[model samples]
Target: MKKNKNLLEVPNINSSDAQLKKIIYKVEDNIFNRFFNSFSKSEYLCVCSGGTTSSCARDNFITLDLRKEYDHIHLEKEKNLIKIGGGVIMKDLMNFLGSQNKIFPTGLSKLPGAGYLLTGGISPLSRRYGLAIDNIETIKGYLGNGTFISLEKNNLSSDQKLLWEGFKGAAPFLAIITEIGLKTFQAHPIQIIEGFINDNELSKIINLAEGFPENLSLQWIYAQDIYIYILAEIRNDLDKEITKKYLNKLENFSSLKIKTYENYNQINFFPKELDLFELNKNNHSEVISLLGEDLKERIQIFIKCMKEIIRSKPNNSCYVASQQLGGKTKEIDPKSSFFIHRKSTWKPWIYASWKKDDLKEKEIVLNWMNESWEKLKIFFPKIHLAQIHNHLNSHEEEVYLSFEERLSELKTLKNICDPESILPPL
Candidate 1:
């Protein structure tokens, strides 16, 4: 068995070194077989893709780091498809797509590749183009039993089709995705409006946003004070007037201080030179709430609960944030994937971070987060696995809540593909 050590130094899979290529091919062929046939379970392999937002990457399992091995990004403009390596980071992917005048629905610019798709990626553009899973045409990866698998919707058998559906939302449990082929859209300049608003004014903004057009997306981060951010993209020159009409709706919130930026880079939505995963490296916990259209009525109550939690928080680093989710996201066919919370209008999440080795602070923040979740969950019952999975204390029950009735079907598919349970527990 390979000893547990940092796999960061491993070279890319495309390296010219003949010796390394031979070693990687040999490892790939026998790794899964060994796990299935071996009596000793002393060591297990866990795949890593830069460890950007996954707690699994930091665990004690022997790491199979893909960041150095499979970071390729290829664009096929004529076909409107892009094939991205699992190890590619969102920043690099977005920049490459931008240069080619194309775009894919990746929720955040800082997120890693595979985890984003495996967890049912909810993007800023999801309101228009649908979730990232909806854009996937094919996924090439290795099943837990060391068998290589290539999946595409049109070419799958009945059983493979079932596995494909599960792969769309719960892929981390079934396979280690190596590359993904996704549909792309024409790139357009974005108009950004950002500002602050009080909790009382949050309701009015939510009402206005509920009726927003497909071109606009609303996102907000509520810290000690609530800060609002909006991104409106014009797919064509003709859509500018419609975009302006939507922006005008926000004027109703008098307390909202807003500023507009034309032709902004979507990446600028996050802080430059900051690694969000690194910021929460020590002790961090996040609870998600998938709020439906009823959110219009419960918006104030939700904000109030978050305020109370913030007031009692151990530190100022923790906050409440949400992303708009309805538009095209709800229009996807129910049988297409395991992402079942299609009717949800907003995905609100609570994030808390503390210093390393500060067990007291960690306990306090986790308790506060869990308490707040209990109160807020009644308003938004569903959870998005992409934001919270097994690595972050999420169990099979909680993870299955995101899939609802489809959980059993997904589990059967998991049993067939990963009988030895080589992947993380879901």
Candidate 2:
């Protein structure tokens, strides 16, 4: 086995390189085939993306780092499709699309890779275009059993169709996706209003946001303070007037800052403070994302719970945030994807962080995250498996919540695709 120490550097600190023994940097056809067939069945194998969000690696695990090998971007203008390697990051993809005057549904942070799409990507414009998975036209990858498969949305046999559905929301647990083809959209003007809000304004904002148009969406983060962002796609004069009326309602907030961009990629919703916190080399963090219904009646109680949780946070890095997801997202066919929470209006995620290798701090932060999730479960019951946590005690619980009814079908498909359990446990 080829052991390249430099290949071990992933974004998340939870899976330290010190714990890994084998990392294959070569992903070419013949080399990868040889490595895959020869690797021991007992060994834990994970395909690491360029923008890894968590430490999916563990002690003695083997990783296929696609960062260098799979970094190509091929755009088919005639077909309005963008094909990218698994290692391609959101920022790079957006830049390329912007240069061509095209757009895609990318999340606020531009660091994530294909894992974002495989997890059912949620973008500010998702209210209009639907989840990222809904736009994926093609997928090519290798199942855990060393089988290569190329699947397309319009062209698939019955078995290939079933596998395609499995890959949509449960890909990390089934295959190593090497290339993905996503349907692109025409670039349009984007309007953004971002600012801080008091505890009282949060409820009002959410209430008003319920009636937001398909092109408009709300996102807010609660750490030491509450920050809110309203994004709208300005397609015409009507859109501008609608967005203006919504902004006028929030004029009571003195800190609101409004800006217009040519495309969604130009807008960055994350606060600078949080960005700086993420830049801290000593920080190690984990996030659990949960889905919920509209908090119309439980707004106050939800705020109170968040306040209590924040008060007990281990550090400044731990916080709870949510994004709206009820417009076009809910209009998709229920049987199409693994994201089954069609009635979900919000996706709230708890972020916990501490200094790297501080075992005491890690334990405390993890406890805080777990407790926060439990408390929020009263309002937000479903889980969004954005990142698989094989190391956590709640891994099974998260899996149960994420796949729900389709889980049995998924299990059957898993048996056929990954009978040896080479991928993360389902």
Candidate 3:
């Protein structure tokens, strides 16, 4: 394949040294089929929806950029469902769904693309409604062997049924999704309570949140300071009183702020200091996400280890943050998707970063991230394959941990669907 020197660079959210040999834009049926048939088997292949995952492109790989061509969003009111193209991001999806008085499970930040849904999207709202994958009703994509496939929940052959199960949580390894159909819920009134607290209060909050109803979820971050955020969906006056009572039980909170929003898109989950725009731009970062049960008795020891990790931070951006995930998320059957760790109550991610092109700082920060993961692994035994790290040494281990007993089955499907290994390796 000849390189397209004039083609604009793939704008990935996570800045990395990985380079693309050529970028194919406007991937219509003709272009996609032609490219898929023409590329040599030795050439690596990947897709860029919102340009977030590291595995989207490797050194000299041919990348398909979906941002321009596959961004259509349509709502099917009769079924209360929405169909979004591969290129759509969380912000656009939320804003569009909000206008229609509908909601979907999206992450705390709004920039991730289809990969978020493909990797089993976890949101504060996920505690009530299920994971993003659980909402998928239809998927249209090309399998690794250059065959166009469209599968719906209601109609599927045995092979397609197996492919459907794999697409839910292990899509990137199976095919290139061009569009997805998702079930949307009626938008509801929501409230947010945010405050900064010390280590002691953090433990207290975690314990208190463990017993919270499905409508309430907790997300906490330990950066320069510890910040706790609570998301409550108000179905009635009772929920409001219950949220207030929980707040009253807390001992101390700095800069406590409470606000209610009429819909999902109207809410801002992060503080001004940790702006999403700033975090995405002008920085190179890596993240490793973990799934674990409630800390409970291990809260104190976990906190101690966390404090040490925070104190030894390589930079201001390196920190640990966790989100609550148990309630409705656990209701789904384990066999339904590749997300086997449904028993998890918390999803904590270790993040490390350095200035772009700062190789020395990159080495130091990556070391810190791995070391921090080593200390916290005992508490968080399962890994979450949220962000792809195929280029890193932990890729195989993370993939295995993400899908333990199911790995062998997924591999068998990989051989049948992706004999040439066109998609990311299993």
Candidate 4:
């Protein structure tokens, strides 16, 4: 593994406090803050992928960066398994896997951390194979006091499986993850195809997604119903002809522009090992959360709302679009820690981010996202899976507090694992 240029390397655990202190002084602020913050909390809100968890933590409890302090990976080349450090970032792990021509499920963004995903993940590839933790072989962490233990597939005895089953989707309780032993795969060839629909041809957009194959996953984004983005991932030769099939169907819509990234694996090979901090660290100009049905009318309605929001904040560069919770993901036994939807799962988020100083603009976009969330509640009731964490805008926040039982369980795990609360807490 190569050293990241921007941050100094963390020394092996054997170093003296004086030496460790000197070494840590040279790293980046977020990473450093996160590293020290991990152990400082007698209780903490640990954060990984989505930024909101950290935001919420800062407001409610003591928080820290688990990315450095807790995330540890130990690769066993002979065993064909890697004990991943809890703090590992998404790009680093995916890129590492890419290098091996291997694959694991990942969220819409290439930058989310593995810590967040394996515990409660929703990835582009999750539909067919499984959610992040669905593929897990084992989990190793703490019940409390820095004592480490490993949970393996063999440990899923009838009695233990019952307890483990209860912990999925809910936050961690009774343990803090130090590392996870994950099942890895040889690379699967893939392709990326994107569709852009014109404002008027919106009906066809929904039709296209509805028609996507089991092997193909697509996301539709409506920007005031005027700008719609649909991104799809196609596995090798499932339909062999879906490429042309989708292209032709999309053409029926007026003013549609599409980009088909054939042989996408060739472009984004496994284990490419890109640095995560490099990617996620660059926040988008604008991100406002929205909720909508995977269906077209809901998307159109959301887009109309977004158009008004984006128009006011032109700097808002992009909105994340996803079709969440179809495929085998829904099929997975809801009991596994891998699956976490209390209700219907919407597609990936349409995330928007702006500069630090853009308070007024930020307020406008965030309010729009919240308003969009509230506006769509009636339609959302139709979804039977689970709502994602990010969409819990102002109103959604209250709704999420309902999951406290599960969350409380996760917190119990944290207390037991890092009684000092040094590890990241959800």
Summarize candidate 4's per-residue lDDT along 1-426 as a digit string, tens digits: 225322222221111111112122111234423644554434343333222232313222332335656555566667667677666766667667666666666655454454355445655565566676677777765443534455677667664563354334432433445566777655554555443455446455555565555556655554333334444555556455775677676665555454454322334311114221112333323232323345545657655544554454333333434455556766775545524453444543434444435577567556655554455555453221222333234424533442433545545554544555443333
The per-residue C-alpha lDDT of model 3 at residue 400 equals 94
Ranking by lDDT: 2, 3, 1, 4
List the candidate 3 regions with Cα displacement exceeding 4 Å: 1-18, 26-43, 251-254, 271-282
Candidates 1 and 3 compared by TM-score, better number: 3
lDDT for each candidate structure: 0.69, 0.84, 0.83, 0.47
The alpha-carbon lDDT assigned to residue 380 of candidate 1 equals 71
For all predicted structures, in order, the TM-scores are: 0.87, 0.94, 0.93, 0.66
lDDT of 2 by residue, 1-426 (tens): 226564366666665434566766555556445555666766557777754566456667777777688889999999999999988889899999989988999887787888888899988889999989999999998887778889999999977887888888999878889899999999889988888788888888888888899989999988888888899998889988988898888788778888889987677668565452344557888889999888987888988898899899988778888898988999998689888887888999998999887889999999999999999999999999998887789899999999999999999988988887878878
**Best by the TM-score measure:** 2
> What TM-score does prediction 2 earn?
0.94
lDDT computed for candidate 4: 0.47
Reference-based TM-score, model 4: 0.66
Candidate 2 yields a Cα-based lDDT of 0.84
Q: Rank the candidates by TM-score, best first.
A: 2, 3, 1, 4
